[model samples]
Target: MSTSRLFSVLDKALPDEKIIQDFSDRIWNDKELNGTYVELNNEWKFIPDNAPLDIVTKALFKEYFEIPFGTYKVMVAIGGNYKSGTWIFDSKILFCNALS
Candidate 1:
């Protein structure tokens, strides 16, 4: 799916902050998975195997709301082998600015 379409689906699937938070928290707290996430240049990126993409994608989607403006990158992999190149969230995608 396209990035915007993927995000739209995620928005529909997680319609509220509470649900997003709960789901993201689970991924953030996962012992094995949590270590896979990192922040670089204000962007949050995670490399996960294909099996966990759904959960990880949701977690990154939640990050879009919680963090200051930045990109979210996902790099899919398996058994320490990368399956694809990075998918960077569009910089043009705007979110509500708390300071505004």
Candidate 2:
């Protein structure tokens, strides 16, 4: 299945896409995040819905309230709480922010 939904959330949440990434960061649009990201790739199995994304991500790091998959200039997935805001933004946020 396409991970488009997951990517959408990440892109919307962050203020600066290049400066940061969020939870759900490890997962890519086309493939699973790499082994370097063991917590995401090795530990948690992906749940299909974004609703549960925050709860699951919280277990990893609460301070973030999200996940940043790769480091700067990287491929990442951002974690988001569906209750907090819209699932997708028309043009405000960029995919790079989600990948932060």
Best by TM-score: 1
lDDT of 2: 0.33
- The TM-scores, one per candidate, come to 0.21, 0.19
Cα lDDT, model 2, residue 79: 38
Model 1 residue runs over 4 Å out of place are: 20-57, 60-100
RMSD in order of candidates: 15.7, 14.5
Candidate 1, clashing residue pairs?
Answer: none
**lDDT per residue (tens digit) for residues 34-54 in model 1:** 345545469876633232222
Model 2 poorest ten-residue lDDT run: 52-61
Question: Local distance difference test, per candidate?
Answer: 0.39, 0.33
Location of the lowest summed lDDT over 10 successive residues in candidate 1:
91-100
lDDT of 1: 0.39
Off by over 4 Å in 2: 15-100
